[model samples]
Structure formats: structure tokens, C-alpha cells
Target: MTPPPGWYPDPHAPHLQRWWDGAAWTEHRRTPEAPTVPVPTPPGGGTGRARTVALVAAGAVLVAAIVTGAAVLGSGDDGGAETRTAPTATASIAPESPGPTPEESASEPSADDPSVVEDQLNGVTFPLVDGWVRPQYVAQDDVVMTTDGTYDCPGDGTVCRHGLVVSRTVTANDETSPEALAKADISDAAEDAYDRDAIGQKPYGGMESHELVKQGPVAVAGRAGYYVRWRVHTAKGPGGYVQSLVFPSSVGTESPVLVRFVFDAGADGPPLADMDRITKGIRPVGDAGTGGGVGSSIGPTG
Candidate 1:
């Protein structure tokens, strides 16, 4: 016997099966095969595991944001006073606005450009004016200004630091006023150079004496600070060098923004006058306090 067209008897056990279109059986025989065993996963299950992973990722992002915010706030103490009052008006020569030098003209912006000098050291950014070169060596606790270059003039056995510098941590603060900081930094720089008369000296020609000029109270980012530009119109040792100094208000973990533009006196004019102008162009990087753009932080100041 022959089975029906749509039905086929199982040869192995005499069970019946239904035929599909043409190729094989559509319905199974009376006796079916045992189901395959499934592998067991952890109790969490796949969906639960996916959810756990997502939660962990979100948690990590939140932690990172919190850490970043804290870092921005707890980095430095920049809430110093906005002191720009000029020092005692000792005999000083009036400064003429000198134009940018060839080298400076190529690299520095105009006097009105709102660029700020950035000194990044010890994980803090102190904005200074342009024309301020980072010193290779400085006198701060964390920085060291050296005299490896040709000491054009030596005072007390130290090289006359009279070139582009690249020092770390040049700006700093210590519960002091900005004016106080500028004065102290300028004085300190004079001392550091092993020259007593290079910074605070007077007497240009005839009966004129040149003094340090302090200009600022300009908006450094958003915080208030000042730039001190001074000139020493005399000869130190035999160099006949006239020095210019730039000091910014904020301080960092490394040092204050101490910059010097030196020129040998008896030249046409104070060679650093233009340099001072270029330095003046530098403003604070971002706004001073919170609400300022990136890299800005807030601190309490008296």
C-alpha cells in the first residue's frame, strides 16, 4: 500500500507525516524529536546586563563632569585686588609710543589687540600680556632662571639676562594687592639680575630721569589686573643697558608673569618702549571668574 498524496507514513516507526509543496514534509510525524538544550546565562540576564552597562557609563560621565568642575574651581587663588595705582612719581622720562620691531612686528599683535600671554605651569594657566617671553630660568621656588646664554654684562658674577626668556610659573599671588605684587616683582627681577641700578635708577640726559611706568586696570579676561612697564636709564657695570619690565596681577603655582625687555642705553630711544606696547596687547585668556569661558575659575579675594 500506497499512502495518500499529502500524507506519507514514517518508514522508521510507521507514523504518518504531511507533505509540503513538493520537497519535504510540512507536518511532523506522530513521534517528534526531543528539543535542544539551551545554555544558561548568569542571573542578571542579557537585558539586565545591558542595562547595568548603560548605568555604569552614565555614572562615569557624571563623575568626570564633577571632577572637571572641581578642578576648574580648586586650581588657584586669583581673586586678588585690582590694584593699578601707579607708584610714587619719582623723576622719570616720559615714554614715547614706539612702533613694533621687525621681529616683534612679525610675531606680536598690535597694541590694541586683545591677546593675553599664557603661562601654563603646575597645571594652572596665568594670563599675561604679549611680548612676555617664558624664561628658561627664573627665581621662583618651582622655577629657575639660568645664565647659560652669553652674559653680555655681569653683575656680582651673574649674567645680564638680556634676551628672550622662557621660564615656568612667572606669575603668582600671596594675599597681596596687584600693585604690591608688581612692585615686588619688578624689584625682585632687578635683584635677580645681580644689578641694583638697572631697574629703579633715573637720569637719562640733560636733567631727566626715567622711571618705571605701570599701565593696566585693563580687563584681564574678566578679572582686574595691571601691567607695569618700567625703564632703567643708566649703565650697569659696562653694558649701558636700559631695562624694561612687565608684571601682571595674577599668580600661579610656578611664578609671577615677570618679563624684561633690555636694551643698551645711548641708543636712539628706549628700545623696549615698543616691546611694552606689544606686551600691553596681552589680556587675560578667558573671563576672570565663573561664567567666564573655558579655563576660567573663581576664588575669594580680599
Candidate 2:
């Protein structure tokens, strides 16, 4: 007789239930315990003992076959009914714990933080002195310049203000010496400020003329470099002193990087001594603080 369309004990092996689609078995099967029903075995006897052993072996083989069939069927449409059992078991398990917070996830050190401020691009670090604040215009990676104040130029002219300008740049070439680079940079900057027809004008009302008061070698993190001191005169009258330093990369490489420190002070602004101290205090990310004295003509060496 044909069975109804539902789960029933396998006719050949009654220990396990198999799905019968009215006319025939459809390959879906489960142990009696799985369906919450106990399979009945024949009364204890020599033949019954053997039959019971055979049923246990057949049940093991049935489980193995089910697993193998599930693997072969994969996620095909025809295997939807077979895949539900595995997912149900998975669903019973608790989900994973929540992850870290947004702040915790983004733990990168900030350059704006004076305590831990660092120039990752140039591989240098320095503490922010009192009364000096980092301006929003200067990017963190390029250079960290903190100033006592800023000069807002009047009208469309690019000059007419006086403040310190500190920055850095990294280059990949060893063809020129540090002193040569410093001289060239200073010359170009002076031309930009003093030359009326120059392509780019300097920031502070374009200096009328500038004289190189003194220039000599300096050092940073034990790496050789050079510094140039300029006595600039602008349209507004004696535009204070300007000091530029070119620091070669301390981390040894064929192509040394350059870190520039530009200090532009008005005739009545901060003393040259203060600028000298700040320049000397610059050290590679982490180094013991050392004091240095400024020279009469030129600034202090790093």
C-alpha cells in the first residue's frame, strides 16, 4: 500500500523516518530521536540481536549519505528543503558580540594635539610653545606651524602683514648639497618678494629689497644642514628679519628630504632671540631637549 505525503518509518529500515511523497520516498530522512519518536524493535532473540546491530549500522550509513547529498546539492533550488535543517541549527546559536566604537576604531594620533603632535610626512616632532597656535591654513602633514598671531593683508595685495611662517618639504634627490639648496631657496624667495615683475609675490607686501646678513651650516637630529639670515626692507619700511633653514633628512637615504623653517617677524614684533630658540628646539620626533645660544650676527645652529 502507498503511504501518504508525510514523514513515515522507512519500510526497508524502520529505525529511521523517510519522507514519502504519496507514491515514493523523496530522499529526505532523519533518525527516530530527531523527530521525537522512538522506533520499535523486534523482541530480544538471537536473530533480533543481529537485526538490531544491522539497523544501527544502516542508521550511521543513512546519516553519512544525507551529509554527502547535502554537499553535492550545494545551494541549488532543488536542495532548498534539505538546506533548511542546517540553517535552523545555525540560527539557534547566539550572534557575535558587538564591535568596537567609532572612536576606538579610529585611534590614529592627531597632529592638532600639541602633546602628541608629529609630522608623519617629514618624520619630525616638536612641542607647541606657549602663546602659539596652529593655523587652519597650514596642513598637518606638510608642516606644523604655530604662531603667536597672523597679519591680515589689506585689499587684494598679497603682502602688508607680518608673522612667522614655518613649513617643511620632502624631496627625493641627493644631487645638490644642503647649503646649495638653502641658498637657492632663499634667493628665489627674495626675488619673489622684492622683484615687482616676479611670477609669484612674497606674503608680506613684497619686500622692496633684502640683504643676506649671514648664512652658515647647521644640524638637526645630527644631520648636516644650512641656515640663511636675511635683513629685509619692504614698502612699509624695514620689514624685520627673516631666517630660513634647510634640514636634510636624518633618516639616512640616498635622496635626502628637506625640512624648512621660515621665521618672518616685523620690526617691532618678537625678538630674533625667541625665533632662534624655537628653531634650535626642533628635533626629530623624540630627542632629549638641549639648550643652545644665539650668535650675534647669525641665528643658532640646530
Candidate 3:
């Protein structure tokens, strides 16, 4: 019974208070303080044991403020590292296209392709004469027809034309004779349009000599084709007229087709008989449109 010193509680930390000193306990602990309650003085007549010690000190301060608000809401989730918790939201959505499928609208390119210089992968279609057309960037290929505009390059600032044309699909060599690929493609189609013009600019002032103004065999689109035609002689104005014209494909791997030509040689060019009326209007791509020339009318002489 050696108990008569100061602070008590803490019989091994019961919410603090230690310091006994009458028998042992010392290491001075603290916390546990609220209990003092002895103030009812000013009222000279308030008995009943001072109103039951002020109602037991207001019910021990409302049970120590509800156990200190339940230990501060249970240590607010280990209160310290800036609480976070927030994730649960999603909604992306997208997928619904559908439309083109007749074999992808027959392999795309229609509004433009069937317009002119139609190669449609060598099915053939280059009709359109009476001032040739098509190729206003319609997927432009191998110069593919021109001469509906552009004039200037009398020297070279670019652009000059009295006629133009080009088509492809010769699969480079293995000569399948269209008269030896139109005599080996009329000297590279007279040096690609009068020697230099596809932006390398030399305009007519280039190509100074060419000849063979005729060769043979012709009847394109109805197959059996060949052509040569030349005349070049540039270095100035009114000097042009090249040609090539192979031909084979009426559809698929009959592959051959070449077709080339220029013009410009005075009289505002375009009429070596519209190069046999555009080689008598090449057809075969479903044929039929006779508006601007149509094949089978036959175009001959070289």
C-alpha cells in the first residue's frame, strides 16, 4: 500500500499520468489531466451539495467530448501523407463505319479515273479528243494528257504546251514487239516532251533534232498496235511532235499498253490529225462513249 505521491493512472500507460515517487513509478509521463471541478462560489445561497457538484462537472465534460470525437475519427485514415483515394471513371466509345464494298467500290478511283487518260490498271480508256481533257490533278500520272491550258515557256520559267499525253504499263523490256515497243518508245518519247520540261525547264529551247515522222502498224484497243512518229527539232518555237503507242491489254495481264505523244509545231499545234484522232479514240474500258472520239474507227499510217 505504498501509494501516496503525485500523478497516477499509467499502470503501464493507461492514457498517461505516471510519476508515483512514493514507492516506484517515475519516468514522468503526462496526458490525462481534465478532472478538477470546484467552482460554485458567487451564489450566496445555492445548496444541495452545491447542486451535486455542478451536475458532476457537466457529466465529465460530455464524456470528454465523446472520447475526443472518437479519437479524431479514428485517426482519419492514418492522418499524415495527404489522403487521396479517387479513381473510377471511364467512357470512350467509337466504331461504326461501313459503306464501300463492291470490292472497295471496284478498287477506288472512279469519279476521277473514268474521267480521262483512263488506264484503270491497263484496261484501256484514253479517248477524249476535240481538245483533249482529264488530268487536272486527277491522280496525275506520266503527264497524262494536257494542252487545255498553260502557255509561256518560250524560254523557260516553266509551263508551255500545245499538246501532251502519256500513259504507261510497259513493264520495262522483254520486248513483245509492238514494232519493238514503238521503236523503243520513240527515243524516250522525244526526250520526255521536247527534251526538258517536267520542272527541269528548258522548254522548247532544248531537243534540237529528231526525225522519223512515221513508222507503222496501228489499230489499238482492238489490240494489234505499234507506232513511232517523231519530228522534234526544238531550241525554239513551233517544233514538236513525238509519239510511241504500243498496245495490248484489253483487260488484265495482256499488259503492254504505252501511249505517248506531244504536239506543238505551229498553227497552235494539235492536229497531225489529232494523232489519228487520238489513235482513233482508244477504247476497251467498257467502250461506248463516242462523244470525243471512240476506238474501232481505225487510225493508221505509222
Please tell me which predicted candidate would have the highest TM-score against the true structure: 2
Per-residue lDDT, model 1, residue 224, is 46
lDDT digits (tens) for residues 37-69 of candidate 1: 223444666676666676666545433332221
State the weakest 10-residue window (summed lDDT) of model 3.
87-96
Once fitted onto the true fold, the runs of candidate 2 whose alpha carbons sit more than 4 angstroms away are 1-117, 139-141, 154-161, 170-174, 191-204, 252-257, 265-268, 289-302
lDDT of 3 by residue, 199-268 (tens): 5777777898887766777667666777778888888887878888886766534667787887887778
lDDT of 3 at 61: 57
| lDDT accuracy of residue 85 in candidate 1 | 16
Candidates' lDDT values, in order?
A: 0.33, 0.47, 0.60
Worst 10 residues of 2 by lDDT: 85-94
Give the Cα error of residue 135 in candidate 1, in Å.
4.5
Give the lDDT ranking, best first: 3, 2, 1
Candidate 3 Cα RMSD (Å): 38.7
- Candidate 1 clashes: the total is 27
Model 2's number of clashes is 2
Error of 2 at 8 (Å): 62
TM-score of 3: 0.25
